[model samples]
Target chain A: MGNVGNVWAVVAIALVAVATFSLGYRGSRHASTTQDFLVARRTVRSRRNAAAVSGEYLSAASFLGVAGLVLKDGVDALWYPIGFTAGYLALMLFVAAPLRRSGAYTLPDFVEARLSSRPLRRVSTAFVLVIGVLYLVPQMQGAGLTLGMVLHTPGWVGALLVAVIVVVNVFGGGMRAITVVQAFQYWLKLFAISTPVFVMCAVFIGSGGTHGGESRGLAEPLPPTFSAPTSIDVTTPVTLRVVEPVWLSAEGRVDGGSARGPVFWGPGTHEVDADTKLMFPGGAPVPSVAGTPSTNAEWLTPTGGGTSDLWTTYSLIFALFLGTMGLPHVLVRFYTNRDGKSARRTTLHVLLLLGLFYLFPMIMGLLSRLYVPELLVTGKTDAAVLALPGKFLSGTLGEILGAVTAAGAFAAFLSTSSGLLVSVAGVLSTDILKGRVRDFRYAAALAGAVPVVIAVFVRPNDISMSIGMTFAVAASTFCPVLVLGIWWRKLTPAGAGVGMTTGGLCVLGALVATTVSGYTGNWAPWYLQQPALITVPIAFFTMILVSKATQRSVPADVNRFRLRMHAPDPLGFIRDRDVARFGTAEERARLAEGRHRR
Target chain B: MTTTEQKPDWEEVQASPDFVLLRRRLRRFVFPMAGLFLVWYLLYVLLADYAPGFMSTRLFGNINIGLVFGLLQFVSTFVITMLYVRHANKNLDPVAEKIRNEVESRGEEK
Candidate 1:
C-alpha cells in the first residue's frame, strides 16, 4: 500500500492543528510582557498545568516508539514506559518543591544564580541545548515515520512540516499559547488513542478473536504467520530471516541483485534491497527483520530481547529514573507552579495522568502483536498504533479510527516540538546571542531548523534508543549536580563545574565512539550503549572529591540560600532576585511587587 | 546578594526549634522513602535482567510474572504518590502552616 493517503486521516490531522492554533491565539491576549508570562503561569491551576505537562512530556517516543520497541523486543520493552513514568516519581519526591522554591527557572539559570559562576552557566547552557536539540530529532523522525505510514508521502515531508509549524508558533512569542494548547492536547490524545483500541477490543470479543474459528495459542513455538494474502512495501534495505523455505512473489531488488518477480528463501538470512515489494501467501511464517526474536516463546522472555543484560538494564534504569529532574523543558515548566506546594501538587497530578495514559499505548502494543506483526518484519513497528486501527477494521470505521490515531500522533510531535524549540531559543537568545543583535526571533527560527535538517540526513530505526541517549546525557551530567547541590552544604562552584565538564565529556566521547563505529545492535558493548552507569557515579565522586579539595570556596551565603529555598512559601522570605539579575528596570520592580503580594 | 556580618533573619529561622523540627521531619520522610522506592525499582530491574526465568514464568492466560512486575511498577508509583500526599498533609503541612502564620503576623523573625 504505497502513497494511499487516507482522506479521513488527513482531515483529522488538520483539525488538530486548527484546534491548537485557535486556542493559542486566544491565550495570546494574556501574553505581552515577560511579567505577563509569569502571570499566565501563576494563574493556571495545578490540574491544568499537570495536563499541560503530561501533554508536552508525552512526545512521539512515548506515543509511538514504545509500542514499536514492544513489537520488536518482547516483554523487555515494557520497561521503556515504566522508566519514563517512574522518573516523575523521583522528581516529585526530591526535586519538585525545592527547585520551584529556589526561584530560578531553567537548570542553567538555577546553577548560575545558585553558584554565581558564569562559566558554569555556559556549561549548563551547552547541555540544555545539546539535550534539547538531540531530543527533537526523534520527535521529527517519528513524525516522518507516521506520515509515511498514513499519508504515504516521503519521510522528509513530515519532518519539514512539523519544523515550520513549531517555528512560526514560537516566533510569534506567546508562551501562554503553548500552555493552553498543550493542556488541550492531553485530552485530545487520550480520547483519540483509546477509542480505536476500545473499538478493536469490542470487535475482537464479538468475533471470538480467532480467524477461521481456530483456537489460536499466543505461545505457540513458531514464528508469526500471515493470516491473509499480504503485500508490504519495504522502504529501506533489510536483512530478513525466514524459519523455513517458502515461495513468494517479489517486485524489486532481492539478495543484493535485481529481481523481477519470484522468490524462495532458505532457513537463514536473505538481504532485501531498498524500495522492494514482497507478497506472501496465507500461512507463510513471517520473515521477520533480523536481530529480533522470531518465535512467541522467545519474544515473551525478558532476556530474549537481543542484546539486553544486567549492566545495560540497570544503566538504562538510571538514565530514565534520575534524568527527569535534569530535563530543561520539564524542570522549567515545573517552576511555573504558583509555589513549592503547588509544584508538588502539579507533579502528583502529572504522575496520575501519565500513569493512566501509558496503559493505552501498552495495550495497543500487545494488540499489535496479534493483528499487525508484519510491522516487525518491515522494521516499522513505530507505526503499530496508527496502522493497527486500519489493519483490524476493514471499512470507513477503520479509516475514521486511523484518522484519530494520526491526529493524536501529530499532536504528540507538535506539543513537544513547541516546548523544546522555545526552550532552546530562549537559551540561545539570552546567553549565546546576547548583545550581538536585537531580535531573537532569528534565534528561535535557527533553533527550530537545525533538528529537522539533521533528521533529514540520518534516520535511526529506533526512536526510543535515540531518546535514551538524551536521557543518559541528562542523568550523567546534571543529575549529579542537582542531587549534590541541594543536599551537600560544601559543594563549591569549582567542584560543580569540573564534575559537570568531566561527565559531559565522557558521555560525549561514548556518543562519538558509538556513532563512528556505526554499530546499532543489542550486542554492541554495554559501556558504549549504557554509559550512565559509569558516568553518573563518576560525576558524583568528582564533585565530592573536588569539593573536599576546594573547601574554602563554598559560598558564605549557603545558609541564607538554603533558608530561602526550603522555607514554606507562605513565610515569603524570597524577594525574587533572579529578575534583577537579568531583567529591565521596570520588569524588576514589577517582579518585586509581585513577590511581595504573594 | 547581601553578605551581612550580623546574623540575618535566615540564621535565626535556621536555628529556631520549629524549623529544626520541620527539617528533621521532612528529611525523615523524603530520604528513606526515596531510597525505598529506588531500591524496590532496582530489584525489579535486576530480576528482569538477570533472572529471566523467574520473570517469564507464566502466571495465567497470557499473563506472566514479567508483565505483572511491569504493571506493578505503575501500581507502586500510584501508591507512593498517595502515601507521600497523605504523609505531608497530616504531619508536614500543619506545622509549616503554623510557622508561616506566626512569622507573617509577627512580621519576619523576631
Candidate 2:
C-alpha cells in the first residue's frame, strides 16, 4: 500500500552493504595467512564476541519470521524465540567451555582431533555441508523476498546479491572480517527492528488501544479485523479461506481468470493469481491463508487436546534447546574468546543480549495480528514486520520505519550468510580440500553458489520453521556427539561415526519421507519429520552402546585427553602436540615408561 | 627418542588430590545445574502444550500463565548464567588456575 518506503529501504540497504564491505575489507587486509583467515588470533573481548555471536545468530528467522509465525500460528510461536535464546543457556552449561578448551576450530577438526579418526572427520565434514546448506537456504530465500519487496527486481536478485557479496567478503577477509561485520549488523538489526515497535506502541497507546475502537482485550474470542480499508497484493497465487463474505474488488486474475476490471469475492475459498490486488472495506474480517486459525480463541491456545501437537511441540523444544551447541558457526565463534572462562562469560552475555532482542519480536508480532491481519491472506507472514510500520505510520515517518525493518532484515540475511559461509569454507578448506589460501577462496565460492541456486529455485517456507528443521537435524546428529565426547570418555571414534550417521540419516530420511508424501496434517506422524524426541535418545544410546562394543578401539591418549580438556588452560596439558619440549626429567621419564609399556 | 619425552605424567596428575577435588567440584556444579535447568524448562514446555487451559488463565493486564511461563524461561536463563558465573568464580576458576600453574612449574624444573 505504501510505495514511499522503497526509496528509504534502498538507501538503508545500500548503507548496510557499504559498511559491511568496508569493515570486512579492513580485516581481510590484515589476514594473509590461512590461519588468520580461518581462525584469526584476534581473541575479541567477551562483550564484543557476544555481540558478534548475537548478530550472526539473529538471522531472518528472528527478525522477520518470528513475528510472522506469531501472526499465523498464534501463541505457540513464542516458544521459538524463547527456545532460540535458551539454546545458548544449554550451550553455556554443557558445551561452551569444554568446546573452546578443545582448541579445534571447526566441527570436523574437533571430531578428528578428539576421536583421532580421519574417516570420522570426513563424516563430520559431510554433515557440516548438509547443515550449512540447510541453514543457508532460508537466509538466501529471505534475502530474495526482502529485496524483491524493496527493489521490485526478481526475487533471485536479492539471493544472488547476498551470495555474491558474502563470497567476495569471504575471499577478502574470511572469518576475521565476518566477526566485525556480524557484530555491527547485530546492533543495526536491533535498532532497525525495535524503533518501529516503540513508535507503533506509542501510537496504539496514544489512540487508546482497543478492539473496534472500543476497549476489547487482545485475547477476546473474535477474528482479527482490518483497522482500515486494506488492499492485499498476492505476488504468489494464494487460496484464501474467507469466513465472512465482504464486497472486495480485485484488479487482476480472480476465480474468473484475467480481469483488468474489478472482481467480487464471496465467503468461501477462492484462488487469487499472482500479481492480483484485492481491496476490502474497513472492519472486514480478514481472510486467512488456508488452514490457519483466524479467531483469537483458536490462535491463543496452542493445541486442541491432540497427541500430534504434543509430539511436535516436545520435539521442537528439544531441537531448539539442544541444537545451538551443534551449530558449527556458533561453536566456531567461541574460539574468538581468549579461553574457556571467557567463552562461558561470552555465552552468558549472549543470553542477556538475545533476551532483550527477542522481546521486541513478540510486540511486533502482536501488533501485526491487529494492524496487518491481511498478511494471513497471502500466507506470507514473514512480510508482516515489513508491512506493519507502513500501515501504522503512513507517511515519511512510516516509510522510514519500514526502511529500518527492511535494512535490518537485509542485514540479517547478509550477516548470517557471511558467518555461515565462513564455517562452510573453514570445513571445506581444512578438511575436504587442502588448507591452502586458494582452496579457502574456492570453498567460499562453492559455499555461496550452492545455497543461492537452491534459494532461487525453491519456494521459501516460513523462514523460522525451515530453520527449526535444520536445528532438529543438528540436534539429532552433533548434539549427541559433542555431549558424549565432552563428558563421556568411552566415546570411540567408531561409535561417533556410526552414531552421527545414524542420527543424521534418521532426520534426512524423515525429511524426505514427509516431503515426498506431502503430509501436511498435524496428525501425520511427524515423528519422522521432527524426530528429536525419538531420535535424540536413540542417537545417545547408539553412541554409548557402540562405544561400549568398540572399547578396544578407544584412543590410548583418552585419559590424558580428558586431563587436557578438563584441566585449566594455564596448565600445559593442552591437546596440541607442538606444546612440548618443556617437560621435567621426571615427566620425561614417565612418558618414556608409558610409551615402553605401550 | 625425545618425541615421547615431552608429555608429563597425565594419569598421575589426573589422580592427584588437587585435580580430583577440582573435577569433583566442577562435576558437582555442572551435573545438577544442567539437570535442574533442563527439567524446569521441560516442565514449562509440557504445561504449555498439554495443560493449555491452566496456562491461558489470565493473571494481569492480558498476561496469561503461558506468557509468564515463556518469559520466566528467559528469566531463569538469566539467573542460571549469573549463578553459574558466580559459582565458577568462587569455586572452580581459582582451583583450575592453581592447577595449571602447578603443572607448568613442575615442567619448568627440567
Candidate 3:
C-alpha cells in the first residue's frame, strides 16, 4: 500500500510540476517591464483572469479544508464554500470595477491615493503584510501536510520544497507567469477532483449502491476526545497505528457518587487509567474509550444540532464571506486587468470557475465519509481524498486516480504559495524595501524566504483553523479599510489609521491569545477562536465614528477622488449627455476650474 | 467692413461621423451590462443566505440544490460576460470605430 501505488503518484506529480514550471517560464518571456511583473501588463482577459483567481483562491484550504469541515459538521459546512463564492459576488458588485478604476497596485496604494497621505499608506501596508504573512502560514502548512501524506516525505522537507519552487517561479516569471500557472492549475484541479469522483460514483452505482440507513445494533456512542501518543517523542516520526477500540458506558459516578457501568474494549480502541491520562499524547486528559462497532460513515453526514454549535457555524460563514474581500493575494489579482470593466468581468468569471471547482471536493468529502472513515479516527483526515482511491478502487484505475489527486495537491500548493509570495513580494518591493526594479528581484527572494522560516518554526495543528484565523484577521483589519475607504467620503487619515491599528492589533491579539491559551479555557477561548462576529462590526463602527469626529479635518480632495472612482471612463457608457444628467458635468467643470487656477 | 466681420463660428468645426457612432454604441452596451451584472450578483448573495432548503436538496447522488445555486453564481458571471462580449462586438465596437474615424476626421478638418 505504501510504495506500490505511491510511485505512480510521484511520477504524475512530477509531470504536473514540469507543466506548471514550463507555463511559468513562458510567462517570464512576456514580463520585461516592472508593470508586467507586477500586474500582467493589465492585459489579462476576463475568462483567464477569472480562472487564475479561482486557481489561487481555491488553495489547500478549499481543496482539503472545506471537505474536512463538511465531514465533521455535515451539511452546515457547505456554508464555507457558499460564503467564499459569495464574497467574490460582493466584490463584483461593489468593489471590483471601483477598485480597478482606482488604478492602484495594492490596497495600500488605493488608500494612499484616496486619502492623499503617506502615513495612511504606511499604515495600510503594515496591515497588508500582517494579513499576508498570517495567510501564508496555512498555505505552507497545507503544503507540508499534503506532501507528507501523499509523498511520504518529512513535513519540513515538503514545506521547504514547495517554498523553493514558489520562490523560483515567482522570481522568474512574476505575475505574468503566475497568472498562467494558476489558470492552468484551476482546470487541472477541476479535472483531478471531478474525474475521480465521477468514476467513483459510477462504480458505486454499478456495485448496487444504496443510501445509508439507520444503525440497528446496540453500540455506545463515542465521546469526542484529543490525546497525544506517548510513544512518539518530539524527534520521533508521527505515524498512524491501530489500537483496540474502547467503549465505555457511564453506569454511575466515580470517586464520590454512584457506581459506573461496565465498559467494553475492542479492536481499534485505546484505553488508559484516569490518572495515567497525562501520559497520553500532549499531556492532555484522555477519555476512557468505549469500544463500539459502528458502520463506517461518510465525513459529510450531518449530526443533529447542539446549542454551542451554532455560534461557530455563523462565525465561519461571516469570516469566509466578509473576510474574502480583504485577502491581499486575492484582491491583488483584480488589479491585473486593464480597466474596471475587465475587472468586473473577471470577477464574474471567477465565480463560475470557483463554483465548478468546489463541487469535486465536496463530493470527495462525502464519499470519504461512507467508505474511508478510518482516516478520520487516525487524525489524517486531510488525506481523505488522496487515500480514497486506493481504498475503494485498485489496480491501474486506483493508481491513476491516486496520481491525479497527488498532481492536484501539488498544483494546489504551488498556485496558492505563488499567490502568497506575490503579495508578500509586492509589499516588500513597493512598501517596505522601497527599492527599484533590481531591488524588487532581491526583495522577492527575501519575501519568499521569510515565510518559509516562519513555516519551519510554527506548525499549526489544524490547517483549516489556521486559515480561518487568517481570514478573521483580514476581515477585521483590511475589510474595514476597503469598505470605508470606498463608501465613506469622511474617512479621514486619522480615522483609517486608528481603525487599521485597532482592528489589526485586536485580531492579532486574539490570535496570540488563542495560541498561548492552547485553544482551551471557557468564554475567552471561544472569543479568541472566532473574533470576527464582534470585531468586524466594531471596526466598521469605529471607523465611522472616528471619521465623523474628525470630519472638519477631512481632505478637500476626497470628493474629487470619489468622482474619479465612480465616474465611467471616457470610452465607457457615460457620455457627456449622461454626465449632464448625473451632475458629473458640474463636478468635472469644478475640477477643470481648480486645475486651471492651479 | 473689417470691424463688422462676424466672429468665426465654432459650430462650423465639422464633427466626425465615427466619433458620434462610437459614443452612441458605448452608451448602449457598457452601461446596461454593468447594471445587469450588479443585479445578478446581489440576487446570488440573497439567495444563498435565505434559501437553505433549496440549496440542500439533492440533485444527483449527494449533489444537492444548494450546490446548483452556488454553481449558478459562476454561470451567471460567464453568461453576463458572454452577453457583454456579444454586445460589444455587435453594437459598441462599430460605434467605437466610428468615433475613432470621427476624431481623426475632425483633426483633418481643423
Top candidate on lDDT is 2
True interface contacts reproduced by each model, as a fraction?
A: 0.53, 0.58, 0.04
lDDT (Cα, tens digit) per residue for candidate 3, span A111-169 = 87777789888888887877877777777777777777666776777777787888888
Tell me the TM-score of chain B in each candidate: 0.84, 0.84, 0.64
Q: Candidate 3: lDDT of A493?
A: 83
- TM-score for all predictions? 0.92, 0.92, 0.74
Rank order (by lDDT, best first)? 2, 1, 3
Clashes of 1: 0
Q: Pick the candidate with the highest DockQ.
A: 2
Candidate 2's displacement at residue A227, Å, is 2.2
iRMSD in angstroms, per model: 5.1, 4.0, 11.2
Off by over 4 Å in 3: A1-4, A210-263, A266-307, A519-524, A570-598, B1-110
lDDT of 3 at A167: 84
Tens digits of per-residue lDDT, candidate 1, A1-598, equal 3222389888988898888777877776656655333225455678999999999999998899888888777777878888898888878877788778777767887787667678889999999989898899999988887788777777888998888888777655445678888899999988888898899889988888775442235677677777677788887788898876778899899998887777888889999888999988877778789878777777777763333566677677788888887887788678678887778788789988998898888888877777777787788888888888887788889888888999999999998988887667767766787612233467778887899988888756488887887888888778888878777778999999889889878887887777756645344465787688888888889989998999998877777677666667734445554465445777666665444211
lDDT of each: 0.78, 0.82, 0.64
